[model samples]
Target: MSAEAVSALGLLGRVELPGVAGSICTARRYVRGVLRRSGQRDTYDAELLVSELVSNAVRHSESGRAGGLVTVAVANCGESVQIAVTDSGSATCAPRIPPGQDEGAEGGRGLWLVRELSLSWGWHEGAAGRIVWFRLARR
Candidate 1:
């Protein structure tokens, strides 16, 4: 599933939260509940990816500002789970790997991990904000 997953998959789990640091854990727990309700037991990877994306949205996007917000959605495709995180637009930022980033650094590998762990991932930018999403094969 790709962008079509958003519509084709029919978002089963969705949440809106203040773009605060602690929301990362809240988003993870929410996803776990979504997965649990769907009868999926292995939730570690999905939770980790949601955490990274939420962290990025809160840390790098304008959503981090006072009164800002972020939205998370999860869709269950037949054989895969698609998750998306949308944040208020950032004037100076969109998703990307840091240029010439050090491989041994302690951080800055969130998107890298998403790219590696997800089956397929992409983003869509609209007037409201940009939504970055990843699809994971069901286990």
Candidate 2:
């Protein structure tokens, strides 16, 4: 559905989370509730994608700094689910899949997993902040 339609229909729900490591789980729980209420069957993959997005925001953005917050939005548009995570922007970088992977590293695979699971994904710099979003086809 169109962004305007999603908002107009009130199909969207959002939660603001502390930009801390532990908030990842909280974001997942909040998304779980939204997905369940919308009767989404692919909750597991959606939750995982949300976690990765939030984790990336918390780990890489200014949001992870003191007193910052991350905002997560879930939109259920009947045939698909849209999830977006907004973070305090970083002056040094934007959200992107890494150019390559170091299998030996302890992390940095999150976005790759997101790409694998999401039907479509993208990010944009907006008036509110930097937002990364993904959509999954309903089961």
Candidate 3:
């Protein structure tokens, strides 16, 4: 885990990772590390959810560029954990429960997975960029 993960206190943990495809794994590792250090249980699903969100940011948003950035904020807010990924996306496209994707479709299931796994999810524009967030209840 990086130093920021520990320093960004007040809501469990937070980390800012590069907005690139390769950074997805790093983000996941950071999530796992924070959860473990904080003694939060059942991180597998949270890890998966973070993976999907980061993947979407890298693939569809401007954050994938060389100098682009993505910020992942994780917070343990009582019975549930809140995770948010802010990217340098151009448009403020809100995430939705996507319609049934085609069998032949190459991609487009990331948000769908988030919808299915998270207790609740949403997106909004922020000063930095677009933010996609989700929450999962502790089991």
Candidate 4:
């Protein structure tokens, strides 16, 4: 993490959720509230990004085996906000843009939207699991 990244955003809130479908929505709202109060105008984008990250953790990771918790952390820098969603699974799969777009498709495209909307984004391997993080500049 860059000093610029850390200094800009304060620790707004941290949440731990069971790896379940419903938890994704809960995490999304939690993060959205943090950003909204931190003066973030792009609530929709933030919500979508948080949803995608949490959804991935819940659906892809092996649930109940060793148990898992989806951790959502929001930081508000003066100029931008950073959100990190961490999971307790070692799945090293990185998010990517889905090739081609089908209007009828029901999956993919989360990371694509994150890249398009966020000013900066990346992931890091942590001891507990992987952390997928994104930053949006205040507009």
Using lDDT as the measure, the top candidate is 1
Error of 4 at 94 (Å): 3.7
Candidates in order have lDDT scores of 0.87, 0.84, 0.79, 0.75
Q: Candidate 2 vs candidate 3: which has greater TM-score?
A: 2
Q: Tens digits of per-residue lDDT for model 1 on 1-139?
A: 2345567887787889999998999999999999888888898999999999999999999999999998999998889998999898787887997777688899999998898899988877865588988989877
Query: What is the descending TM-score order?
Result: 1, 2, 3, 4
**lDDT per residue as tens, model 2, 10-36:** 565888899999999999999988888
Question: Alpha-carbon error at 2 in model 4, in Å?
Answer: 11
- In model 2, state the lDDT of residue 82: 84
How far residue 102's Cα lies from its native spot in candidate 3, in Å, is 3.4
Candidate 1 displacement at residue 31 in angstroms: 0.4
How would you encode candidate 3's per-residue C-alpha lDDT over 5-88 as one tens digit per residue? 224534676678887788899989998887777777788988998999898888778898888888888876677778888888
Candidates sorted on lDDT, descending: 1, 2, 3, 4
TM per model?
Answer: 0.91, 0.90, 0.85, 0.81
- Best-fitting candidate, measured by TM-score? 1
Candidate with better TM-score, 2 vs 4: 2
Give the Cα-based TM-score of candidate 3 against the true structure: 0.85
Residue by residue across 1-139, what tens digits does model 4's lDDT show? 3334444566777778888888878987897777777667668888888998888878766532346678888886668778888776545455567788676778887777788889988877666577788987765
RMSD of each: 2.3, 2.2, 4.3, 3.0
Q: Give the TM-score of candidate 2.
A: 0.90
Regions of candidate 4 where Cα sits further than 4 Å from its true position? 1-9, 63-66, 100-104
